[model samples]
Target: MSYQSDINPRHSTWRKVRHTLSIVSHEPANLLGALLLMLFSWIILAPVMSVLLNAVLVQSGDEGRTGATEGTFTAWYLLRTLTSRMSELLLWTPLLNTLAVALSTVAMALIVGVALAWLINRTDIAGRKWFATLLIVPFMLPSWTFALAWSTIFKNHAIGGQPGWLEAMGIQTPNWMAYGYFPIVTIMVLHYAPLVILIVGNALKRMDSQMEECARVLGASRGIIAFKIIIPLVRPALLSSALLIFADCIGEFALPYILGLPVHFDTLSTGLYRAISTRQSGVAAVIATVIMLMGMLTLMLDMKMLREAKRFVTLGGKGVMERRRTLGRWRTAAAALPLLFVLLGVVIPLLTLFLSTVMILPGRFTAENFTFDYWIGHNLDTVALHNGILLTPEFWHTVWNTLVIVGSASIACGVLGLLVGYAVMRCHFRWVAAFLRQLTFLPYLVPGIAFATAFLSLFAVARGPVPALYGTPLILILALIAEKMPYASRSGIAAMTQLGKEAEEAARIAGAGWFARIRRIVIPIQAAPLATGILLPFISGIKGVSLFVILATPATDVMTTWSLRLIDYNYQQAANAVVLMIALISWAGTVIIQKITGTGLADGLEK
Candidate 1:
């Protein structure tokens, strides 16, 4: 008899029920795992439900304002948003503006990313390796890393009090070009291009050369082979990169906050933020729901693409990889382009920051303008002057808090992600698996502000020992963990899938303990993925200021918060300095992890 049948008596309805209960009762790990999973799922799902329900219904006072009955189930909310008074300001115009900015951003990003990918992966560019290392600098920081850069160079006295680089040098920069759509698009593109670069770079490296050779043998020209073969093969990467940029841009906050508001430009995030602050939370939630719908639609589109993707899977291990294409005369031009983009996008911003932090005066270029006062001084001449971040004990405390929160959450998510991946991939419980998968992945659909609000509502007041964690470091950690777990766990599952079961079976044959086998074999072999899992969250956590912005207190502030404080105080120089510091720290961490683990930032999604 098989082990399953021999261990049980004849099954009856009550007996079966009792047996299942007993099995579950005996398995502490599984039971505990399920409970944690369910709790987290509830936390994520309930907020989304609140926003969705509120979006379609007539919000309190909304009906009275519109001369309709209160608490009615009319489609007025959707109608007004799509057609009535605020449609131009709140819906159609803002929507079009968002599309224009997002598309322009996408175009600029693709141009930069694809070009760099080709140079680093396919061509014998002079500094291919160094370029690869530095390419992710923009991604590790907030998308607004270069906003300060743009302002420092082209403010034109329209926003910033003093002249920027252009105006100082007798250039009368256009106000629109300096502040609104142009600067916003440029910064976003520079920030997100690295994602495309990483994905496309990996695709280029893994692409088998024989397919291109076959195309050539069929009398296809180099341009034709390149277009028909190379581009088609990497379409998955391109599409994936494009969709992420779109989803992120649609709900973006920080960039619009910095660049859009100065010129009277408004996108959904900035517009919604204003509404929430004015206690029009109902309307803000409505905007949140709109963005959520867009996210779901894009996710569906990606799924459809994956399902219908044909003629795109020519990757195989049978051919010798081709020699790198020699750039020759074009090498200088190719190398210059990526370097120039990085210089404008990364180096210029950083240089501007260095200038600002060291300068005692905002715009002067003398050594007397430099000071360590901002870095280390205590008890300066104002009520807001707490102390320098470098000198204050509080600064180190916040650093510790940030790391503790980010690290604990990441490890927890990584472990849960492995379990999730394994259950979804290997188990035959289809409906359960599907439901659970969707439940866990649902947050990717919800906007960060909406998610934060839901969490605040749930945890702000004391409900037993689950005490009010609002503005507490614990809440920040919990939120970050919940958000980043899906990514790490999916990576774990991907890595595990590539590994066969033979090793585990062989260990079992030798009568080795399950724990021993897992510790000695499974973990060692899966090291790369587990490492990748942790690395992704760390980088994301460092840049994730906006999600924490509304929720964090001074006691719980991180580097991003510090930058916001500087900006709020109108200390642009200091703000840029801090922003640069955070970006460099994140970028350095990303580069270090990639070097140590041989994994790319996009490995989780791209694979």
Candidate 2:
């Protein structure tokens, strides 16, 4: 109150306005950045607004029942979603399962990933580099790949499918082991653990080892050192990995759909997918909003943990080198453990898929049962599909669709990301910079299916200036651009942070305009990261299913959707072959990008 009373209040409104305008006008880039930021905020917020609106507004049938006109606001959806008899099954149970899976995944990923991080970064283990490289292979593969592999091995005839490999080998797998939470959690762990590994491994690699040696000289026990010193030091990485894994698993749909649908076990993502498919738009909106809120809350918690962790920073101006731990007899065991994980996560799953692709009947290894029909043979007998995937027009159509959609989306993401990085790093206004940064990250936190549904609601009908985009490839591209912006933006920001403004400033002094400066100076300097940003999303999009699954129509089928359709018709061999092809394509794209950029996937991931 005292400060407020003492503050000068003599500035005229006109003067304030002129001052602000002058500040912006002096730097055209600032003006352009501000406008772009506002436009991007509108783009990102549109679907979210639509989701909120859809949740409250009554549809035609609902309006008829409630004696209200269509699109009129009503509490009926909220009442039903929150208080109805079906609420338990519709909302609470799925929410609980989602939390459980997210928590369990965090626990599993941290244990395996952190241990591996320690082993690779701090120990004299054999094949450390090989383990470090191979462990992340599963991350590149789609999560559903693991789900398919799991089903190929452990599936039973309990639900009227062909017996799995275990059954073929005369070992009966329980339904619990084959599907639902167990398999879902396991598959997610394998898929996401690599993220944890990369983050924690990088932290451990950069850590100063002198502190540990000092603790050892101080007569600290190994247990004491681990709990009192090591744990506290790596806590930031541990918490970060946990936050990422939790956020990802909560939004994950493919594994839950493939593994949970048969047994009627639903997570938030699968539930949202079913709601949208069944045309329960209002219910779907509510679920999506809830998931978005959960993501925000988790992100907030991550921020809080990060703030606390900042107090424990170990890096300093002093040069410190990490010393490897001598494992002696335990070295072989440590190396074997990582190799075993690679075998379990990478080798086994891929082998299962390849074997299934060749098998006339999935899970049967008999020579007479093996065939190339799914891969190359013509005139193959299947449901709607009549030939090998390689021989089908449908396959080529999907390949074309994939290239067009993913390529366009990748370019959009890369350009937009570069602009965002430029604005956030170079802008003078604090609030505008912060807003743009957070807004760009919004899509990554929202569940893919929920985000797709939001897209459907917002774009299904033409409103005002925006035209209808539903069922079009444009919608798919837009959705992908939104969902993948986080990756591209982060890459751009990291690259840009390393670039000095001196060259750009000099270009400006020499009478270069904003666009010219960016084109000639910024783009050339940050080309590697720009390439990585574009290519990472392109690789991810090539095999992506969850984000586009809700949006793809028959005419718009990509490889993943095509494989899911094949699976639906019980064409296991064709489906497996399609999945294998997708893996190869993604791998090839990653390699090509790395080669072109002179940066490996591991290097990019570590950044």
Index of the highest-TM-score prediction: 2
List pairs with backbone clashes in candidate 1. 360-369, 417-489
lDDT by residue (359-379, candidate 1, tens digit) is 665566777767877777667
Tell me the lDDT of model 1 at 18: 91
TM-score of 2: 0.93
Q: Put down candidate 2 lDDT per residue, 423-497, tens digits, no spaces.
A: 888877888888888888888767677788888888888989989888789989988988899899888878878
Which parts of model 1 have CA positions greater than 4 angstroms off? 1-11, 22-33, 57-80, 160-172, 211-219, 307-310, 378-383, 392-397, 419-430, 453-469, 495-531, 595-607
C-alpha local distance difference test of each model? 0.72, 0.83
lDDT of 2 at 442: 84
Q: How does residue 166 of candidate 1 score in lDDT?
A: 70
- Using all chains and alpha carbons, the TM-scores for the candidates as numbered come to 0.85, 0.93
Give the number of the best model, judged by lDDT: 2
